[model samples]
Target: MAFDGTCVACLVHELKEQLLNGRIAKIAQPETDELLLTIKSTSGQKRLCISASASLPLIYLTDSNKPSPMTAPNFCMLLRKHISNGRIVDIYQPKLERIIHFTIEHLDELGDLCKKDLIVEIMGKHSNIIFCNENGMIIDSIKHVSAQMSSVREVLPGRDYFVPDTMEKSDPLSVSESDFIELLIKRNMTLAKSLYTSFTGVSPVAAEEICTLSGIDSYLSPKELSGDTFKHLYNQFTIYFSAVKEGRFSPAIYYDGKEPKEFSALPLTHFGGYTRKEFSSISEVLETYYASKNTITRIRQKSADLRHIVQTALDRNKKKYDLQLKQLKDTENRDKYKVYGELLHTYGYNLEPGAKKLEALNYYTNEMITIPLDHTKTPQENAQRYFDKYNKQKRTFEALSKLIQETQDDITYLESISNALDIALTEDDLAEIKEELINAGYMRRKFTKKKIKIKNKPLHYISSDGFHMYVGKNNLQNDELTFHFAVGNDWWFHAKGTPGSHVVVKTEGQELPDRTFEEAGRLAAYYSKARGSEKVEIDYIEKKHVKKPNGGKPGFVVYYTNYSLMIDSDISQIQELS
Candidate 1:
């Protein structure tokens, strides 16, 4: 679920309990769209982060502090001057909308206690943190929205502050069953759309959950539902809303395998097949889910250039490979042409001049065959022409075979680089990959005189059996780990016939346990493109037997003798060395 009205309501409930009488101690604007407020309550000091980022609008309690600028912004200064020491009189959500109103009691210039409302709206692009008087007139906002910016409402100072009721949605907590059924019937859209359009703060995920709970197809229109079905659906809505009203919030994140799919302020029974991880507070759930999501998002953003380069090259090479394969197939008849020339020379010694055709016996197949000849040339001349044609095609076949092999190698190298980017967690990892691309001639080197000093290293993990296993993140690391770092007795592991990391288990002149071997194989599979597979085939060989061919691509190796194993790609239980 999104950080919808229900999520905000949960946060409001938590805030009302934890920070009802808290006094504002400090305030700061660390980013253009974010505000950090420190409040001193009866328990202790607490940090509340309010962000109105157009991409990710969020509000949550955090323990971390962001560094503020040397000079404060005008809005931050205004907040400090007006409500730096204001007591939080009340905190509430408005009709299940994605908005929170914090009513603060503050002392005015005349020493009289006055009330003010600091509103935080969590709408996507229209999100804002606004300061207003008790009369609901906006004093200022973190983001100034003028008449030109929005036709719905203006968030500038002196503007009337109100929750823009553009949707005209009813409060789900108070709506009757008949009204719910009627609202659904009024909408011609799907059942999911009707649920969100008819009620405030119910996201598509929540709507889908309602439909799933009621045993109705979310894609089906409300007009298709029977009266009994509508009643059952409304009953499910009441039960879901009752949990919200009764404060039975279960902050949880649903995971598809190892990746977080979605999070909700309440238990999502519809996500039964997915892994559900519940936290004690909604803040924790939001923080954990977003932190993981942000890390993955940032890595993808950083690796976009690398991915584009690899994918473009891969496509070109694959096309070239296909064309080369066709040319090679065309040359498959070169052997037949050679046999034709030989048979024609033997069978046409006494033929008439410019013989158009000849009958010959195929010595290999022991069968009679017909050979066509050029009418303008003599029998011997026609045989020589056939030989020349055969030689040309034979040369083509040889050249194309090598070209095809090289093209395949190019595709494999790019794919390995792509797989490396998937596991690249730091800028150092990306730097190493970029350097490898430069060295491999995929990317041109800049005109800088100084050489790059690489700081990235292989991932080191201690197996369950206490054997040290190292996994390379990219081709450069793979070469370094296998050739320079590992000893002759050390074991090397790789995903069989695929682009993957080179994994090395340090034997220390001692034999490795079965569990260590399995762990190392798992690492090889997890870092490869086959990470999502149920089981990946891995080949393991001693470092002495695994040899890199001269003039071959980086991380490319040949091992005639090796042990193979099928292992799953889960390495979560393996402990890594810092």
Candidate 2:
């Protein structure tokens, strides 16, 4: 959520609850811009990870620890020298800004007690971890910014440390209703935009939530709102922030079918359609959300080469298929040539010598027709020449018809591979896909002394009616699930006429319920290429009715008799087995 001020406030609240009066046990610098601090509080030992990365700045408590570098960085050593064993006296956020101040009391070089401020600013690219003396003079910062870097403020030693007030936003925690309405009314923008731009900690999502709670349109400008509507919005806004002030947070991650869409420290009622998975703490929310996001991003990056290979082959086959279809169209006139030969043979004897053309009646259509003849050749020879031309085109048509089907098959197979890449979630999935490509002759097989083992498995889910449903992640797995794993009485499902996973419901010789069928259909639609469509057509039949053609590609099957269902790709209600 952009690491907005509200999130900072949430983290600060969590830190105060866990780390107040805690003694710093250990300090480690795993990355140049990151620090892992071990603290001993009343509850237990906790690890606090703080990162001032330019791209992703974060501060959260985590159970996982990272390997530290052999030599400490200058910033890490400086922090350890002064505040290594310091007691955290206080922890607070400044006026709802995206900044946290940790007051630490430690003994000076002469054994005298002194306090220092370890400030963590969660601003986007300007994020920094600064160590300051009691009087707010910067001792050193993890990141150094000179005057040339930023004209607003320089984060260097001996500089007075302060939070930049460039945005000039009001503190939502302290602002009154009159001030809120007056500030919002002055901005000529949408209500949602006005709220975030006017307040320090209000994000766009938070603003939208406030508008939703107040039954007001967030798209409307402040000028369009009546006085009573403004009062209602302000009331909702106060109620929203009061939770933060009172530490009544409900941390959750909202998901759209298994993918995390958004996270919030407070409940986001506007996103009621999403699947909400609440966490006991905001730290869990941050860890799970970012970990899932990183997995998705990493898999995508790893599959780029496979995607390119599949796409290149698909494009080539598609172009070849188009050309073959056009060539086949030209052979459509082969029958006309045959008719011309017959007409010439029937009326050739009556033609005058050196005649350029012969006019005759066609017996096939019982109509008058014209046939061109060679002036130097006899009529019989001309007829024979036409017969040869007809034979050649007939042969061409037959060859092109067979070639066109093969080209079409190649195109479909390549498209299925592309779809497989889309649904691949791990390295093993990609390895299986790469092996398929190598076997299909689209890629060269890399030789190795030892065979690599692939542990990829089909996605398993339990239907609402206590039935088991299995979804194939790739063509190999699809073939295995349908032909080998499922029994004759099992139900088979797939997206109609599209590249998708094969869903098999193990009925165990029992008649399936209607709800099980619908749930299985949803799984088929969700795992297929047409995942986001509102309604997808699914074909279902018994495993005995589904047949795989001899010498056909993997995952290719045909069923003559099957039932069809039009269902959506939403599988949020379905329970998946990990």
Best by TM-score: 2
Query: TM-scores for all candidates?
Result: 0.70, 0.72
lDDT of 1 by residue, 326-370 (tens): 889999888888888888778888788867888889998999988
Off by over 4 Å in 2: 1-3, 15-182, 190-192, 208-263, 266-278, 287-298, 444-452, 532-535, 560-570
| Candidate number with greatest lDDT | 2
Model 1 Cα shift for residue 253 (angstroms): 6.1
lDDT of each: 0.89, 0.90
Model 2 CA lDDT for position 404? 89
For candidate 2, report its TM-score.
0.72
Q: Which residue pairs clash in candidate 2?
A: none
